[model samples]
Target: MGRNTRKRRTPLATKIVAGAAALAVGGGGLVWANFYASAHEDHGGHNRTRSAGAQVATIDCPDVGQKIRDVPDRARGEVDGELASMDSQITDAYQRLATTRRAQAGDARFVENSILGPLKERRKALIDRIQLEINRAGGKADDNLDELAGCQGRPADQQQDGDGQDGGGGQDDGQNGGGQDDGQNGDGQNQDDNGNGVAGPVADDFIDINDVQPNSRNSRNGLAADGDGGSTGTFSTDCGVNENNLFNSDNLIAAPGVDNGAHHTHDYVGNQDNDAFSSDEDLANADTSCQNQGDKSTYYWPVLRLQDGTQEFDANDQGGGAEGNIGKILKPAQAELKFVGSQQGDVVAMPKFLRIITGDAKSFTNGDANANTSWSCSGFEDRQVTDKYPLCPEGSQVLRTTNFQSCWDGQNIDSANHRDHMAFVQEDGSCPEGFQAVPQLQVRLAYDIPTPTVENGQVRNPYAVDSFPEQLHKPITDHNDFINVMDENLMNEVVDCINRGEDCQ
Candidate 1:
């Protein structure tokens, strides 16, 4: 292979998600176990190197769970314990994969065959045993092992069936696990007097199209919101599935906690398994609790919390926080969601199976100087705002604005960089020459953290995202993803709302 030859992960290890229904634990939370890749490198099979910004291909695992229902009663514990073990082994193997990839001479096939393949077998065996327990428990072992097996190590491209569409099979267990799976039980179990629980929502559940938050707040600095001023058409919707405890095993890139893939968890809304490895077909069929029923779009990010000391709201809530790693999840004391158009032309319905990412994931280091970020206090954008994460005052909330480009090049649904196919809205909020203007999605996340405490004569940093021991955590590290599943009627309604300048629920 040439020096620029990016190692393509041939179908070897498929993704196996412990779907929300079957993997849901006692407390109502859900989890899954898998080790797979998410996306591909933009470069032609090249060794990923930062010197030239080479993107390396990775092992994108399939999201599995719906096939196997969780065994009922205490027997569930046995399967869960085994699942936990599989998660650990997978995480360890992938951590090694990540480490080896960093070396110039890293061999992708060797990593898959030697490091990851063995773990896969171990995991399969454990899952087989879990299935037996489910059958013995009278829960009906209706899981499709064939389907689950098919998910292992398949490419995103081949995910489609012969019909050339995303082939989503199996059933949506319908047992919503967002509230229960994140190490807590019941709705509002983690919420306190301040309202920071997994299912607790704040502010207006629906945003008025005419009343949008200021896209740009930085004055002294020339920084603009990622998609600010570029909005030609705009509408708002509620951020879906705001639960924090899902152990979604379909992470494309193996971050710090890749071994127990889902342990280093996130707060998910919208389509439940919105992790890196999810596809359009999977998202489309996902049972969501968001408004506009058929809209199956998925959106997710790291959960933010107060690191000081609350049993459930402790430091472990952030990314890699479970591993005693360096990063912490920063919450926006407040959040907002909106859609903008990237062109002067009428906003059109986003095609099905569209994939897009906001912010940048590669840059989320532990706690380094992060550039290309926008932060502000809920009410005081003038003073409490800066590129640095501003700690919220008592009763005040912090806000981070992430705007994704909406113009599609009309060719590829996704790119190696998770960006290439999509272009940002122009300063005039219009799409460029060959691009079509779609609704640019905006996610405004809020956090609840007080001023950094002065400990040992120094102020500590509070607002941050997940980071690993090796990966330097940076602010630009905060990133999110989206796959539109809005039903045609709902999407058209949004398009009409933007075109007619009418406010809506």
Candidate 2:
């Protein structure tokens, strides 16, 4: 202070500012050194940065043009490849189906040799193979095309940018990518929104069987009757004949003089007084003789004939009594015969004869050449005709064999009967063996049961004679039109996906 030499006093404010500026410069220099060190890091850190650098670098590539100009061409190429593969599979399947159809037809030679036994197995294998191929191709083509169409350009770091917006040494940002945006102008590609390739004018070459409805009437089994009251029960001739008094009793073989086999003695009294009594006496004596022989008082029998013209006895008929002799009872000339019986424990014994024919009397021969060529009979008759006399009642007319012909009424003869009988007259005039007049019940079963055929190792309707209009309309050149429609629909959907730049999977 005494030297006054402390020339000028420095200001406190200026001194403080100078110190702050110095500190700021030092801190800035440290930060710059740290950044430089990181940029030039060693291999260990270098690798990590390199990974990120790759992504960033790729983003610089020009954004894939919004035109997506390559999609249609690529998709079409893929579609063509898939179509070729599908064609091969389809061809194989068609061949198999054809082979199966041929086998099922069973030419006369194949039937004789049983050569078609393996046809079904072959068909199945081929179908499975073709189906697998179709599925594989369908999935691959669908997914691949979709993936290609949806492919987006990499980010800025991954792709080189053609523009020079950033500094010459600018770092890349990994955000830019290419793909269809949500905007309406989307990728300049046309695609069916519903994902059905059928949106455009349908190709004439393409076939879809699904458009046609199947024919329900193709079933091989015949139609069933509409009413519950229709035929029921099996037709059979198992009953045995009666053996007691033949003339008047219900026995198959009644004696000549006793009324033992008599069943309707009371019914005959008013019509013929003396005749009734005489018949009753004859039946009684026959009954006595049968008992002596250890035979039942009454027995029954059925008449069975074979195609070979052989006949067998089933059950015996009950004999008539006092009212009129059983032998004297009349039956309609043109009636079908039905034998009613009672079950003796488990065995049914023949009882009475019922006639089915109505209207006028009809004559039928037992195929006996020596028998009467013609005979008169009532419209309906129930009495048995002796082997020697082929005739109906005095007032009836005769029906020649020519009058009977085959006709079906679509009604089952019987509902309860499961047994079936097929009667056919051979051109040789010989009848089949073991054939008997079928009861109403058995006829229905034969007409209704479905006939089976082997197809692709499985039993199917081989004898199916019915077809629908749609089936007939199908082109013989291609079977795709005949496959289930749903499968075709799915294939169309996949195709649509390929048309549009969308992910099919």
* Alpha-carbon lDDT, every model: 0.42, 0.19
Give Cα distance to truth, residue 449, candidate 2, Å: 40
lDDT of 2 by residue, 1-505 (tens): 0100011132112222222232232211011111000111232334433222111101011111111122232232333233223222322332232223233232323311331223333333433443344345442212222222121112222212332211111121111112111112311111110111001100111111222123311211112111233222211221122111121221112111222221222111111111112333332333222212222122111110111111101001111111111111221122221211111111111111111111010001001111111111224222212111112234444221111111112232211111121222223222245432221111100011122222222222111100110111001100000000112333333334322322332
TM-scores of the candidates are 0.50, 0.12
The regions of model 1 sitting more than 4 angstroms off are 1-233, 240-264, 275-279, 309-319, 325-334, 364-372, 382-387, 455-457, 460-463
lDDT over C-alpha atoms for residue 208 of model 1: 18
Q: How much is 369 displaced in model 2, in angstroms?
A: 35
Candidate 2, superposed: residue stretches over 4 Å from native: 1-228, 235-237, 241-505
